[model samples]
Target chain A: MTLKVYADRMSQPSRAVIIFCKLNGIDFEEVRVDLSKRQHLTPEFREINPMKKLPAIVDGRFKLFESHAILIYLACVFPGVADHWYPADLFKRAKIHSVLDWHHSNLRRGAATYVFNSALAPALGMPLNPEVAAEGEKLLSASLAKIESVWLKGKGRFLLGSLQPSIADLSLVCEIMQLEVVDEKDRERILGPHQRVLKWIDDTKNATQPYFDEVHSILSKVKEKLKKLQAERGVSANESIGRTTLHSKM
Target chain B: MTLKVYADRMSQPSRAVIIFCKLNGIDFEEVRVDLSKRQHLTPEFREINPMKKLPAIVDGRFKLFESHAILIYLACVFPGVADHWYPADLFKRAKIHSVLDWHHSNLRRGAATYVFNSALAPALGMPLNPEVAAEGEKLLSASLAKIESVWLKGKGRFLLGSLQPSIADLSLVCEIMQLEVVDEKDRERILGPHQRVLKWIDDTKNATQPYFDEVHSILSKVKEKLKKLQAERGVSANESIGRTTLHSKM
Candidate 1:
């Protein structure tokens, strides 16, 4: 049985899992749950993931959620590809694990919330809270600074300082990539001053150009759909509601 | 070379590592880093863990931080131990991993912060902010409810529905155990209303009584020392300082 990944491409963690499977040459069927429609709240999806979150996986009889766990599981299950993504050296592996742990509460959550509040909410016809968005921007900036000083410090290119990309790079890229979906002005302000981070993003894209192309194609389609929907609602971008209420169901 | 763990028993993650080592029959040298003295900030400790966090391990040339990573590393390194803690079964292992991931941002950090701000701060002659403590309490309650509904739902005894405890249970118990350091009234509030969680804690302690005994003994010594120091300062328990500062060093 092929691995089945339940995900929504627009979600950051979902994209990271997709990149992981693609990079490792692992084949998996994608099952999309429309977040805008509250599809994840259905009892069936809840059975698979009680948390009602996306980026879950089902492999034969085994099912799992939590992106980092899925990433590690994919690495260990496909041992042939492990050397590239998850190093066997004890310390190196620990560093990778540390970065993944830090990502969850810090970079991934903070960036995703900011993007959702600032961009997705308006697109989805929800009420945007300026106060929340401002708070999120502050958090995103502080979190990015720490990521630079701690994880990305002294690294040659990739997060772990290796010549090749690891799961850390994949996870980090998927997180910061959400910046592209935000208003270009906010995106530039949030990510502009960090040259090393920008270079890292470029390097990640270069490393996974084909996969990045495919992923970007999907994202562009989603963005177009969002834009048309916003036009129909006749609300200006600045007047759009925050997307956080939509996420409250999960 | 003997394994060396730099930890303070007051820390939830640190306690988890120490308990894991004992439960798995792995022998290690314990180097207590006095949090009060700011010992963790010293250059010597920084060389071992740049994060300056507790519960870091040094095995041979390998040094690892992050309690979850250290727990997994120890489990993998020791052979013939309980597989239930870190299961080989793909989905079951993923479940444990997911819970650990959630624990870091949810239960562990929020709960520990609540205890520190509400109880430890006042105990150490620091002013406790009621507003901050209330916010921490709110977050803790939400997290505890989620744990009940998600991870521990319908489980028998341990976290994974197994009679034997897993590392997930150990990590969780150590975190919740920090609440014991809080004053009796606050402890009553947590243990009183959250019976299932309280029961789980009792069951865990009962299962790991020897380890609990050893840990509590060390904690009691530390408590006595702290009490003596407070008395020498002629400060009563209720007297509060303006802010609770994390000792500058550690």
Candidate 2:
């Protein structure tokens, strides 16, 4: 039986997993767990992952959740995967683990929170909380600055100066990709200063190619849906939420 | 040269790393990074770990941070360390990774947030935000319930049905142990419901022995300091901050 991956492309981690499998030419079943419809919360899905979160996998009798875990497992169990993705050397692998662990509370949190409040909230009919959005922007900038100075400091193109893109690069660049849904001005202001980060994103994209674009295409549709919603409402929802003031404060 | 661990026992991750090294008998130098005194934020420490978090390590020329990464590195690098702690088996190690990744946003977040708000806030002369504390409690309860029913479902004494405790077990159990500094009644109310969790905690302590007790002793000092502060202040700080009404609502 092929490895089974339960995911929705809308989630950053899910997209990373999907792109990873495709990039590595790994055969797997993609099981969609729609978050917007709350399909992941169903009883049947709960049996597969009691956490009831997306990006889970069932490999034979083994069950696993958490996207980073799934990525590491796939890389380890599948002999065909390149070593650079998750190096066999203990020291290099440890560095990747450090980056992934830090990503949880740092880059992932800041990027996800900012995008959710800035774009997805109104699309989901939830009011944007400007105070939280302001906080998110601050965190987002800090996270981006760290990436520019620290993670990309090495001579190579991706994180930790790797010749090939690692899971950390895939996960983080996917997070930064979410900014496409935000207002153009706000997104630029948040992401503009980090030249290295922008270049690294492009580098990661070129490395992953068709799979990267394929996994991320859902976000483009999301952007279009958000645009249509604003057009139909006869106003930019961001303006209605006083996003200018929020951006200024940030 | 011996491994050097820069840590402060007050931080949960620091304690986890300290206990891990001691439990496995890895020789190390303990370099204190006093977070309370803002030592981690200094220019010198920043050179070592730009993230400036507690529990960084210097192993020869290679420096790394993030306790989970440090734990995995130590297990992999040091010979004669038992396999059960970080199994070489691909499936079991993946499950352990799943638990550790899930831990950051769930068990660790819930436990750390609740303890900081309820106990550390007053210790640091910061007022308690009861609303946030209530939310923390809800998350804490949900996390504990998941640990009991899902992670500890197997007959083994530790997470993922392991006969021996893994780093995931150490990190999470240490997070829960922070509740000792909270109000006795509140701590019991939050932790008492999960019998398996309690048993697992005891099992982990037994497995790690004197090192677990030694590393955790700082929390006892912290409990005493809190007691002294409450007596000197002549009122419950929680009452001053309206924690009771918030608890009633919750």
Candidate No. with top TM-score: 2
Steric clash pairs (candidate 1): A121-A243, A126-A241, A127-A241, A127-A242, A128-A241, A128-A242, B41-B249, B126-B241, B127-B241
Determine the iRMS, in angstroms, of model 1.
2.0
TM-score of 2: 0.93
Write candidate 1's Cα lDDT for A12-127 as tens digits: 78888987888778988989988877888899999888878888998988888888889988988875676868887767887788788777766876786787777678566686
lDDT of each: 0.78, 0.89
DockQ score of each predicted structure, in the order shown: 0.43, 0.82
| Model 2 docking grade | high
Instruction: Give me the displacement of residue B18 in model 1, in angstroms.
Output: 1.4
Candidate 2 off by > 4 Å: A232-250, B235-250
Please report, as a residue range, the 10-residue window in candidate 2 chain A with the lowest summed lDDT.
A232-241
Top candidate (lDDT): 2
- DockQ for the candidate 1 complex? 0.43
> Candidate 1: misplaced stretches above 4 Å?
A79-82, A117-139, A153-156, A216-250, B42-44, B123-127, B153-155, B183-185, B217-250
Residue A139's lDDT within candidate 2 is 88
